[model samples]
Target: MTTPQTPGTWTRARAWLQTHPRAWDATLATAVLACMIVGSFADPGHHGGPKWGTRTPDAPSLTLMVLGAAALVLRRARPMTVLAATGALSLVELVTGDPRTPVAMCAVVALFTVAAHTDRTTTWRVALPTMTVLTAAGMLAGPLPWYAQENIAVFAWTGMAAAAGDAVRSRRDFVQAIRERAERAERTREEEARRRVAEERLRIARDLHDVVAHHIALVNVQAGVAAHVMDKRPDQAKEALAHVREASRSALNELRATVGLLRQTGDPEAPTEPAPGLHRLDELVDTFRHAGLTVEVARADHGTKLPAAVDLAAYRVIQEALTNVQKHAGSEAKAEVSVVRVGPGLEVTVLDDGPGHEGAPQDGGGHGLLGMRERVTALGGSCSAGPRPAGGFRVHAILPVQNHARQATAAEGTGNRV
Candidate 1:
């Protein structure tokens, strides 16, 4: 915790400094000028330290030193200009005075600014030449030995300034990279969330399509039957009306359950019952049978347990296929549905023995076949719907059950642990 806290605090401080660069530069200028002024008054010749006798510079030389130091306040904005101006001022001081003030401090500050703002290639290019020229000029013109402390001090200060500035630049770049990575991760998370929402909405749409198409078709047929025989056969009409009522009621219940899922948090709770799957196939077939269509179901999977997703998808495929048969094929048609387990996959095939396409009803843009295909494909399965060679329409889907089941089990285990 301490380690993480330390870096966070340091990053905040660096950000503040970057935002107020002018103020920080002004502070640097003030410190550099103060050091030059105080050093000028100290006795350089005294081997005994702590002697501060003033060496009063001429008016013109004092003015130039003050201007050079003050110019450092603009170092961050115009580093090259400040460096050139301060370097020229320091050369002037070295040639005119016997014991010059340390105006080179301003040049050192400007060099640091340049190094921090620019790249290493530019820093090396500028630093090497500035160091050589400033040191040579001081040594050649001053009334001191070539190896004097003042001349060596100038080189040391300038070199340290360049190194320190480069380090600061590197740290700034590192922090910027970390910030970019965090933002990119945030963007990726948002995209994944949107993708999941889209998939869930598609699934819900498929469910609604299956429910509405199947139940409404049955109600329409039974209502037609009820109206057709109302005058002569009143008893048969009453039975047809009863079937209509039952179909409509089932439609309303399924619709209520589906729509409840889309309500807001403040709304009433939705039905908590699990969605329909293979166990409801018999009831589904019975509804079609009551509506005067023959639906045969043959299962050879031998009670093999299925994952929730696979089961739901299988149920939806059968429901949609049967609904298509009821709508397209005539009332005299028959549908056969078979679910078989072959190795690691489950195959569901629905076939209807109706008249060929010339006699079948035109679909007029239905979503049943497309929704079944989407559901099967999403589960990494294959589905095909077409007219059979000698008979009516056929829809076949092969779903890889074993892999999906194991994946769901693993996910459940991980969720339980969490």
Candidate 2:
């Protein structure tokens, strides 16, 4: 069985004292010096004075004792300096025949301060050497002859105090550096996550804008034409109404595809359908022409390739422009559509003359032009739609030519641009 713990035993003793190094140092020094003052009143033998006693300790001259007490106040600020001052005073007491055995105890306070504040290398440079010199000097030169146990006790205690203080200092520095590095790494991870999220939001916005805009515009235009012609040419009117049904169904399917982006867990399986591009321009033009608006499509000097977004944007610009003409211009209006490649970008323009109709009540919030602008701009392209200076309206768009190849090939192979 373990024995009961004592108030101040060797093992685990002073563990808490070691926690407050400076405070513990001051409290210990004051207690020890106060005890020494009391010891001065006793007889030499009764007060542990046969060898390790403070002779003449109660005498009128106690200059070294006073100096050692004053050194305690500034010990934390200048540990090594305070240690040096006390060590010098201890040496003077030993040589000048003063009665102060506890003067050697002052060196313990100095050693503790050196270990707590500075690194091992500095503690060794200042403390170990001074301890060796003072212990050796006192043993050889003090009134006590050589081989005195009291002098050797001073050396051992001072060495242990210095070692303990240095260990504490090193651990404190290591913990602080680790905390700072962890905080910096956490900040970097958060910033990277935010940047990636912003880029994905922009990408999803572009895809949804492209898929929904074109087919919806075509449906709106054809529906307008079907309503106008049913009263004049019923047979031809039925065909235009059929085209409007096809465009509306196509729009619903594309909108479903756009909404699927919200469930993006991984690589999505390819659907049984596909996206429409420029080759569909013929069918698109035919649908409007059947509706009684003459659409002339002019394509020249085609290139080998174009990006998917650019191809899609070009198709949408033409589709939206024609739809606007059918809605705003009179039934008799004739629209001219042109697709031409100039430099690295493709230009699609639809210019129409005034329909020769009177006073139209232009009204309602239409998503047509807004959707067209969104589509072209998503691909770093530009689209402009406004009333023509001649009499009607014109929509001109410039789409970069790099993405035209896949569109051209896809249109040719399908032979059905619908």
Candidate 3:
């Protein structure tokens, strides 16, 4: 008759025993000692099943059983030493006890502990000898006949214990390795995500700088012109103010588009405008022209369609180069822009005819040229910007067309560079 709370109490006791390993070992040793004592009172020579309480173990057998069970308490701490102690006790009982007790059970448990804690090579080295000596002693010297089942049982039990322990060890090692690999993969994924986020931030910063710098420069120039001509030339001043308004509006629109990338997908009023590319090159040049800077454009690209990334990179290179020209070159400086296709690559060049300023923007104080190089290099292209040997600054880039775009074009049967 068990109470309802009995199972819960047993569960808690088991958990506590597991948490305290020394206590658990002591409990196991006590159990083994009881089993050995009970077996010693059983008479195997009796008819039918063995009858308990028909025989009693001598003082020597009792002493050996006690010693063997006590040694098992330290099985996990010093498995080999515990095994040696138990094996010696079992051997003594096998050689001297007239009706041998089951003292070899402790040695089996100790062998198992040794196998579980040590490597396979050491397990084998220790297990074989322990099994051989105990089995040989029991068969040859014990009161039981040489062919008795008890002697053979010693060999079988010890072998099985070693094998079971090795199996447990192998499983433990395999699980640990899997856990470590999973942890390593998770860390790699996190590192890759952080790296990508950093790159995106740098790209957005560059876009913001380009948009604000280029348009704000125009707005400043137009506002200054509007102020200078307000009294003497009302019509000219009105036109400059209109240019100022236009530049400011364009700047706002571009800023909105760039910043909208940081918005959540469900956010309202997100910009749906496509990124500016070479298709908008004319509009870009016109904006600078409206600010009173002269820019000439020449193209030999044959209207070849480009990948969106390449087109956007090409457009930004020209935009940043021209913006530097407007800022660093004298007011009367004229800029020339060229786009040409030379075998599997597109070449873009921006050259200004202004006197070479001693500290041009491309001479490394600004993020404009640095951003340009980063964008080009990211796309596997090369960019060079410096003072030209002849006169003004030169910014040139060679962007390679990726094979995938050409392959897609070929798959479509167009037979032209894409």
Candidate 4:
């Protein structure tokens, strides 16, 4: 809300004046000096007053006024120079004893210049002594009585103006500094927010890379086998083609879920657990059975309470192991899936009793091992998947309990919470 400017008067004039570069400040002093010079030319006793002042014809006082105005203009660029010019003109007024009031006006302008440009210590070094000398000398050095109240009034008002101008400049500098610091802090916050968003994008990209690369590679290999064996082994080729179709569909679905995370709007209808968790272990085991692989599930931690993330990770580990069995393990391979509750953590173990495929190349250039490692680390868990010593493959994950996972991440200086 803007405060209303006073209607058609001094306030509007002042607002416009303030917009100029130090013009309002110098304008008042210039106008007062001009009035003083004009007064010096007025009839001395025109109003029957003892001395109406400014009655003297144009001469040296006019020159002094011109010098004072020029000093006002140069105040900001060269404060000391302006002060010296005005002071010299004031001394001349003291000697001539003409243009009596305007000399005091010039001294006041000089004091303001010193206060606004120089520090307070410097202002004291120059202004205080100059004011004392000017006030004392202007009264005593002239025909005026030493006890004249008019001279004392001049000294008090001029000192007050200088002090006020210095305070205003000081306040403006301080407020400007605070505004700059606030702007910098706000920019820093925005940069930090953007960095966090970029990290999340990287994480989802890795998930898509792992899922698509592994599944599509299997589909490619199966399609090649099906095409090669189509005439001689029609039934075997049809089965391989069916597996390719299933793998491709699964890959498409996983890709969709990963891409969904990029949307800005949170899905109100989205499920809390997007991936199939360990609760679907039976369905997963049956899928492997239908894919012509023997699978056994040993549940040591069935029905145990677990966080959604831990359950999801455990389920994905088993799912990936079985999928690898179908793709890489020869048709007669047997796989074992185990879930156990260990000390402060859940351990998921997958064992395959068939030759595990090694050196599998990925389409997007990331092996499933690398993908699993990233997810496990992000969740503050440990995962190791490799070929077993006895001619098979083993994938094991030990994920902390909900409370332990939160504590572990905090201890590691990661602000991400469970």
For lDDT, the strongest prediction is 3
Best by TM-score: 3
* TM-score of each model, paired residue for residue: 0.81, 0.53, 0.89, 0.67
lDDT of each: 0.85, 0.69, 0.90, 0.72
lDDT per residue as tens, model 1, 1-418: 3554455787887788789988777777778878887877765766867467657556766777789888998887788999899988877776565666778888888888889999888887888888888888879877777777778888898899888889889899999999999999999999999999899899889989988988898888888888999998999899988988998898888888888888989999988777888988899889888888899999998998988888988998998888878878778989999999999999999999888555332356677888889999999999999889888999899999999988988999999999
Q: Per-residue lDDT of 281-382 in model 4, one digit per residue for the tens?
A: 897676567556799989888578777767766776777667776676677789998899887878888888786566332332545667676677777899
Clashing pairs in 2: 55-99, 115-165, 305-404, 305-405, 306-402, 306-403, 306-404, 306-405, 307-402, 307-403
Model 3: per-residue lDDT, tens digit, 299-379? 999998888778988999999998888888877999999999888889999999888776687564778899999999988
Clashing pairs in 4: 39-54, 40-54, 40-55, 41-54
Misplaced by over 4 Å in model 2 are 1-234, 266-272, 355-378, 401-418
Candidate 3 colliding pairs: none
Better candidate by lDDT, 1 or 4: 1
Ranking by TM-score: 3, 1, 4, 2
Which is superior by lDDT, 2 or 3?
A: 3
**In candidate 3, which residue ranges exceed 4 Å CA deviation?**
1-7, 44-48, 362-364, 403-418
If both were scored by lDDT, which would come out higher, candidate 3 or candidate 4? 3
